[model samples]
Target: MIKNYRMVLEYDGSRYDGWQKQGNTEQTIQGKIEQVLERMTGQAVEVHGSGRTDAGVHALAQVANFHMDGKMASKEIQEYLNQYLPEDIRVITLEPAKERFHSRLNAQEKTYLYRIEMGERKQVFERKYIYGLYKSLNVEAMERASAYLTGEHDFKSFCSNRKMKKSTVRVLKEIEFEQQGSRLLIRYTGNGFLYNMVRIITGTLIEVGLGQRKAEDMKGILEAKDRNQAGFTAPPEGLFLEQVRYNV
Candidate 1:
């Protein structure tokens, strides 16, 4: 009988292209897992991810699902995947799922984290995971700017895809910030996000923190609905797919 399985994955995406498989490359998170599953089952296997992360982005609790013909214990399958997959990527958990369950279509919420190092010192081991800025950012100003971003809005200005036909509206539930000495962590929870939306919003907030832009300007930018009205897109190294939430 064909059985369906769900798995939570964690990957250091620095070395991979992204989460999705592309025709041009096999060095993607989804492609790697699919390859291992195909080898194990001796048939083609397709893995579906909750969402796609950009190049060099990381993930802590990405969810995925796949179907296979044979039966195998979840522990054995996890172990096999961990053994064959690269050290940077690992399956955190695996279990049986409903036949109709899908990682993407069933996802309700996603939280992304962006790490910023606000100091002149260079990162040693964490260089590939953090974005470094040589100056301090005003946390208070950033918080004020974030208020305007919360709630449902058409975030067309923040998206990178110029020709996107799908709706650009998304419900950004929250934007929380934490500061630990020189490290600043920003977490964004949303029902859905447009292409490069988080990065662009981060860049806009950084500008507000730097006094390059005012917090109140966010409303105007949102109304403009033009990508050029938004700030630059932040680097992908600092972004991570922190978590995905489902109703269960």
Candidate 2:
């Protein structure tokens, strides 16, 4: 009998092309996970993820599901999978899930984090994980700008140029910024995200922090609904899929 299971995964996606497979040219996180599963189970399994993160983005709590034969315990699968998987990718937790559970379709909310380093000295160890912005940022300005992004809005200005099937509207539950020493973290939780949404938002927020854009300008940007009205999209290396929530 085939059983469905969910796994929580964490990966440093700097080397991969993204979370989804694209033709034969690019290395993707999903493709890597499928390859590991195939090697362990001696069968091909399709893995579904909560969302497709962009290239160079990381994930701390990405959820995915796959079907496998027999009733093997989740712990056994987790242990063996970790042993064979590459160092950058790991299965943090595993559990049997409902047959109808689908990682992408069943997800209710997602939280993403964008990290940046301020000041002169850059941390050599975190160069791959965080974007280094040498200029000083106004945290209060960023907070005020972030407030404008909360609530339901058509975020077309923040979306990438790629085609999207769903509407650009998203409900932002929270948008916050915090500083810890040289690290600045921007956290966003929302019902859904469009392609490069978080990165674009971060870019716009950075503009506000630098005084290039005013906090109130975010409203006009939303109203314009034009991609050109927003700031440039930030680099993917600083972004991370922090968490995914599902209905229990």
Q: Residue 150 CA error for candidate 1 (Å)? A: 0.4
lDDT of 2: 0.91
Residue by residue across 139-216, what tens digits does model 2's lDDT show? Answer: 898899888899999998899864665788999999878899877999999999999999999999999999999999
Model 2 is weakest, by summed lDDT over 10 consecutive residues, at 160-169
Q: What is the C-alpha lDDT of each candidate?
A: 0.94, 0.91
Across residues 19-127, which tens digit of lDDT does each residue of candidate 1 receive? 9899998899999999999999999999999999988999999999999974788889999999999999999999989999999999999999999999887579999
RMSD of each: 0.8, 1.2
- lDDT assessment of candidate 1: 0.94
Error of 2 at 14 (Å): 0.9
